[model samples]
Target: MKKFAVGIVSAAFILGAGTAVFAAGTNNSDNGFSFEKMLPFMQKMHPDQPSRN
Candidate 1:
């Protein structure tokens, strides 16, 4: 029972740390990779198609 409890606590802590790291890594400081900015380029590339869908 004690070992099981310790394992659960460790798993929870690791999961939380992983989630935080993933969230931190996703932030784009340059603002270069945005849908709003890419919309024009995408439209120009596929003029025939209204939307990529």
Candidate 2:
């Protein structure tokens, strides 16, 4: 019973530490998707459609 408790505690600690590290390492600078960036390609694909700009 003691060993099982220790194992559970250790597993929880490792998981918590890993999650913290992953959260800290994330980048917040991503611009994600931009319709303006895809505008030229979209215009080429369908010239008849009016642009939203």
Candidate 3:
């Protein structure tokens, strides 16, 4: 039971971490800094869409 709980906790942590990682590039503005570095990669991922840059 203890091991099962640990596994669930770890899985939740990992999935939550991925959400945080993907959210990092959402604030695409120059107020202080931008996620421009991720833009090209995101564009490549969806090449059919027009680049927003």
Candidate 4:
């Protein structure tokens, strides 16, 4: 039981750290915008754009 708990904790820690690293490594300014991050500009530029399923 103790080992299982430790493994779960370690896995969570690793996933969190990997996410942070990945976010840090992203360009964040590609194509003059980060579509995933800048919603307002996208709305203005492509108001007619259809929503993704």
TM-scores for candidates 1 onward, in order? 0.54, 0.52, 0.48, 0.57
User: Per-residue lDDT tens digits of candidate 4, residues 1-53?
Assistant: 99999999999999999999988877657644576768877778899998674
Leading candidate by TM-score: 4
lDDT of 3 by residue, 1-53 (tens): 99999999999999999999878855657654455766777778988998654
Q: Can you write out model 2's per-residue Cα lDDT over 1-53, one digit (the tens) per residue?
A: 99999999999999999999976665343554455576788899999998766
**Which candidate wins on lDDT?**
1
CA lDDT, candidate 1, residue 2 = 100
Location of the lowest summed lDDT over 10 successive residues in candidate 3 = 26-35
What's every prediction's RMSD, in angstroms? 4.8, 7.8, 6.3, 6.3
How high is the CA lDDT of each candidate model? 0.84, 0.79, 0.80, 0.82
Candidate 4 lands at a TM-score of 0.57
Which model is ahead, 1 or 2, in terms of TM-score?
1
Error of 1 at 53 (Å): 27
Better of 3 and 4 by TM-score: 4
